[model samples]
Target chain A: MRKAIAASAAVIMLSIGAIAGAAEVKMVGTVQKIEMQGGAATVTLKDTKSGNEVKVTVKDDLTLDKFKDKRIVDGDEVRVKYDDGDGVVTIFRKTAGC
Target chain B: MTKILFTGLVAGAVMASAAFAKDHPGREYMEKNGYKGPETCEVCHPGKAKEFLSTVHWTHASKVDNVENTDPAREYGMKNRIYTMCNGNDIVNNLKEIPKTPDAKGTKFSGCNTCHPGNHLSDVGSAGPEAEAAIDCLVCHSREYDHSKRKPFKDDQGRVVLGQDRSVKAALAIAKPTVKNCMTCHEAAGGGVLVKRGFAFTKENDVHAAKGMVCVDCHKAKNHKIPTGFDPNNWAHDGVRVACADCHTETPHKDAEYNRHTARIACQTCHVTRTGGSFAKDFTTWEKLSNGYYEPTTLRKDANETVPVYAWYDKTVANRPDFIGPKGSRSDKASRIYPFKVFQGKGFFDRKTGELLAMDFAPPMSNGDTLAGVASAAKILGIKQYDPVPGWQTVLFGSNHLVTKKNALTCNNCHAPNGVLRFKDLGYSDDEVKRLTSPELYLQKMAEKQREEW
Candidate 1:
């Protein structure tokens, strides 16, 4: 009997916790342009589905061997996840990459 | 056998001498000054040392007009006491050190007690004959004396006994000194200067001052204490230290927080410094640092700190295109949430009307570090997916006074779950802007163009 009561209580607490956590959701904005030599870039399609404007970020990717002029440019939209403005973005496919 | 008798006599002599030292000065001084006696007070009251110290009774005598009456000069020697009675410096040093005492303008220090009597500091330990006691409480409430103590009734056998004990009498028998304590000093007739200013001092009939409150209620203790010294004193006999907060909890903030922020921020945090002006006049200005953020300048006693002063950062807000405003708005003005906020991140107001909506928010800024964190959290909470409104600081901060009968800073402004959290009489709403204004009124008008377009 005690085991059954304990199990029931645990389930109730978990349900309440889950309900409270469902209120807010988080997402990140995409980076558009990367000024390679200057270490900054202007990007479009920022966070929030409602935003039409893009954001800018500095790039420090070591793997990109073509360092000179290969950084991102204006109008280049990329899928990025920002955790407090820091995170990795797997560029699914660089489209309209200038 | 002779040695035994001598030892007993010596012990008795030693104990008596110690007792004499413990209870002599107050009694001797009273007797020399023709005081009735300390026994007169002890007759009407018993076991009141605790309560007496807690009240104005113990301190009242120290404020008597003739400082010599309360603080009779004592001789501690050439280095210490030249000629004195009680330690007046202890009482004088505790009050504010104003440039001049109100009544005694050329004088450096004087308080309300300069008119009243019985504030003798040494009387706390007064002991001795009957006459001295009558002069103490008798000067004010002389009617309480039953006279039964003086003429001891003898039995028919001719043996006498102590008369009606004054020590057992109730505190109410003293009549509470109505005409003397509050009214006498407040009227300026009793010699306190016009501290209240413009208001008819006598018209109020001591309504605010009568209820055990004194001039020190509004005046700073250091500025009002007798000798004009800022030395901290312990008011609580049980060891609780008296401080600015002992009386100033009337406003939304606490004294500890006031002392902490007084240097870094402006003094108008909880007070109405100006005669009649927007809240911004008191809290105007925020400096926008080159790092795409705004910071408040530290206030100085001599001058107002300039706001929106750019440090010419190598990496100023010039690079951030996302900062929304007019196309060519100066980064200095556009970046910071100037006109600083008193509530930090704990209050909210109507985005339009400069009227306060709600205050009494949670987690009082424990310190500057915690304040920064609260500001950051408010920014994140205020952000909407694509909302054009700046962070909460820019949108609502310093815009209105957070008006709530409750704690004056809280999330209730927007989250009033019930509509009760509003100053409807003043036409203010929670989480809504009916009108936005600025300190000079010009910015509010100028900003109107922006608010409308946005």
Candidate 2:
């Protein structure tokens, strides 16, 4: 009984760590390019704050609804959210008025 | 003893009369000149004066809660306070609570009596019924108020001294307001005729004016709350109270396809092809003078013939952002394709920060300047050093005038190969244009196959 309780506590701690490790990363940047291929899009973004360029991959099925009837394009100032663990972009939105 | 008493009474009477004249100088002057003041007009049009006070023309700037406050100049702490050229001396003095610091001399214009007839002289406070009599009712009501005679003289403090000859003429000629009366100040706004916006009110090239529809017809003011059609987020909030659908309903076009296009295309996209012609120049370059005024160096090479740039706009947003680089896709529901008069100019941007500077630097004291009037703006904005960016900034304003339906673009104008509409830039796939343009070929092939089967 003592051994089972210790094992359960260990599993819970591991789950918490896994969840924390996969925290979402948000960045504001201008899109430099979007290369679409095989139901996925690879977007190159130039960070507005840091001025550094980063390439992010977005899967086709990963609900890009924030772009809502619009596709990601070059020269678009967008705010993007991505899962840091997998390094995959999940959401994109225009950051002009907002 | 009788002579002394009589002399004392005469002196006292003179002193009392002098005090009365000093207190009500504006009223005394109007009474002597045989001019009935605003008080007389107010007795008949009582609600007008109260209603006019609520309008942007009377107030100049929108209230703090209004969308105008969301401008980058205000949001980024560049413009500390909303200072308008329309406020009188009394209003300016009352606005001391709003924090503002101007570095340059003679930058701020004192009083708005030059344009606003209802406002009294800067010295004579518009207070009681006697003071309220100073409102010039004929400025808006009369077509005979000659603008050339309305010469404004300012004291050393820049306050407008009223009692000009035009004031009396304005009072006498109380007729209904006409298009000419409205154009006196509006046409000359931003230094010269049609200098502010390329499509601003000019006698020629204005589709509405050519159609015999005056400014008041579309921009009907009720209690002076003139609707400006500025609210982007809500069509209901568009101050102009009128919409294109009001005149041209949902089924304006006879063709089903053309009528269907209305769901995705703005009316001005087809109606207003180009602007800046006739009385106005196509392009104007403002050069700042040593006297701190901007003079336009106009380029009229393509006057009235320049093609308007196209963009997508979401009407629901107040203060729409410029040029989102065409619709991302044809399915973009938030935005409709719209036409714009593109104004290309060199504007200052911070080289270090890469942020566009939001300082007013231009002609027309009311409309804040951005780039050309930077020297004067630097003082007002409290910026010490100035470094201009290398490239030019292209600003786009919606062109809804100069409407010539005959000059409207057809489908081939945009869909053809090497057309003005950049399909790739509009976020269409590579083959989208080829597929859209050559539907006839596919139909021909299908017909040939059907004939072969027969």
Tens digit of per-residue lDDT, candidate 1, span B87-204: 1222221222223212321212222223223322223223333223323453333223333332223346643322322332312234333333232233232111211111221212
DockQ of candidate 2 is 0.01
| Runs off by more than 4 Å, candidate 2 | A1-98, B1-37, B63-137, B156-158, B161-176, B200-204, B230-240, B277-303, B316-330, B350-378, B381-391, B418-420, B438-454
- Could you tell me the lDDT of residue B139 within candidate 2? 60
**lDDT tens readout by residue for model 2, B289-380:** 22233333333212255777666665432322221112223567767777766554333455765434433322322233434444444555
The candidate scoring highest on lDDT is: 2
The deviation in Å at residue B319 for candidate 2 is: 7.6
TM-score of each: 0.22, 0.54
Query: Cα lDDT of model 2 overall?
Result: 0.48
Q: List candidate 1 segments past 4 Å from native.
A: A1-98, B1-44, B49-135, B138-173, B177-244, B247-454
